[model samples]
Target: MHSKTASSSLSTSSRIVLPNDTNVLGNLMGGQLLNWMDITSAIAAHRHCGRVVVTAAVNNVSFNHPIALGDIVTIEAKVTRAFTSSMEVFMDVYVEHRLTGEKKKCNEAIYTFVAVDQNGKSIDVPELIPESEEEKSRYDAALRRRQLSLILAGRMNANEATELKALFEQ
Candidate 1:
């Protein structure tokens, strides 16, 4: 079966950050940022899988700058790696000043998704189509992230670790 591919820049999903999405300090809440990240990342996953995809894991999520209310929030997401029925997506969020239009990098994260069948079980995803050198670099990094994930999960063997090290060195 053929699967459709989709890609979008952070600006494409820009929305004004509202007070409700912010904290008492008038900055966007981390939780709210995460919610948007998950949603946007899922959009990329579904496009790659052509089916329902669930958040299996979020490896690294951190906010570097605060986004204030009235600022434009942009979240860019893309499928960087895929294996069997799972995909690893990388998302970066930015905030643009409402008046000046200057943008600042606010947050970045990596999420793992598993394509599911009607029964909610894992299913195979489509082949990824990397469009540029940067995209391919991100894909390779995601694979390294997956390897580290295995080590963290106590699933990595000595041979696997050696192979992963070699691949990452390239």
Candidate 2:
């Protein structure tokens, strides 16, 4: 498989939060933001694999702040790690106030995707090379996250999670 840098697959999307995108409290709906995050992360996976990819799991998501109507919502995503046929994507969401030009982080999410062939079978993806310090950190942590996810899904036993075991042994 080919080796690709995380920056090569970086994706960013922005949308204006309209009235319809907000709830009765005038804040952007969590579902709507999740949908945006999913799409943005999917783009990053696609760019990395250059093959058809499908969302296998949404590992984690946090709605840290409210985004109001008229705010500009920006979502950034990049591939953090690639293993076999699956890749982990990390996304950060930010909102910019319309009037004050101030920006704040609103959400963060992690999504896992698997590359697939025409017949819907899993296909191997490229290795992700992390460049920046932050990217390297995320890349290293992906193993622990994957182990935890597998354990929680009952696909793997906690005792088999070597990376995760090391964390608590420290």
Candidate 3:
């Protein structure tokens, strides 16, 4: 399979935080943000592989700040790395003040998706070629993150996770 650059899989989306999308406190609901993240990341994965994709795991998600109702929420996602059948996507969420026009990062997440056929069986995905310095950094870190996740899930022995072990050794 031919390798594709990170930019080729970049996906961006924006949504208004309507009243229905908010909590009682008038802030965007965490679940709503998660749903948007999933959709945005899946788009990136699909673009990277040009195949049907399924959410395999949500590796990490952090809510740094609260997003108020009426704010413009922007989500940017890109494929950071691709393995045999899965790809890692990094998503950043920003909230823009309608009046001030200021954008602030409110959340970030990492998700994993596996390419699948119509029958739902996992399929191979193309390699991701990171072009920018930031992309390269995320690409390099993906290996360590994968090893740690596997170890935590009990699918891989900690002793065998060289990439993750290196982090503790340093």
Candidate 4:
């Protein structure tokens, strides 16, 4: 039950959906959305760790709605937790309608990153610094999600795991 001694935050990143960013369905492609998430999350992680960081895993990514072509996708990322050399980054993607300005949450992702030295060797990240109560809550929530993911992964047999995994699908 490790907890952060402090917390960190990074600026938001955004991308405009271009014609090529969409698929045959005229919705934004998952890969393009994932690339936005990964890059923004990495930037947040590096800002927190103050060094180069490499993604260790995208623990989870879930898309809740279709992002239509020309939608502006905004990704907000923050460091939710840190352990030794690794940090967990939580990102939420918002889609704003190009004309009406209506906004909806389209995706959420959790990514783990490992800080690295100039040699590309892993290095310990600074203790997370939580600057606000909200940030602290987000950190705690991330921990709970991690624990739930582990529990679901460990306890479920293949068939059950597959069923539960289906619930996480787009």
What is the TM-score of each predicted model, taking all chains together?
0.86, 0.97, 0.97, 0.79
Count of clashes, each model: 0, 0, 0, 6
Can you write out model 3's per-residue Cα lDDT over 97-141, one digit (the tens) per residue?
988989988878999999999999999999889999999999999
Cα lDDT, model 2, residue 157: 92
lDDT of 2 by residue, 86-170 (tens): 9999998888999999998877899999999999999999999999999999999999999988888899999899999999999
Error of model 2, residue 16, in angstroms: 0.7
The lDDT per prediction is: 0.80, 0.94, 0.93, 0.79
Tens-digit lDDT track for model 1 on 7-109?
5322125778887998999998989888888898888887777789999888889888878889999888888877889888888788899899999887778
Clashing pairs in 3: none
| Candidate 4 structure lDDT | 0.79
Supply the TM-score for candidate 2. 0.97
lDDT of 4 by residue, 1-170 (tens): 23434334574887889999899989999999888888999988887777899987788898789898888999999898887888889888899999999988877788888899989999988778676797787766765565555465574344444434555684
User: Every model's Cα RMSD, please?
Assistant: 2.8, 0.9, 0.8, 6.2
Compare candidates 1 and 2 on TM-score and give the better one: 2
Q: Would you list the rank order by TM-score, best first? A: 3, 2, 1, 4
- Pairs with backbone N, CA or C atoms under 3 Å apart (clashes), candidate 4: 6-128, 6-129, 6-130, 7-128, 7-129, 7-130
Off by over 4 Å in 3: none
Looking at candidate 3, what is the lDDT of residue 1? 86
**Distance from true position, residue 4, model 2, in Å?**
0.2
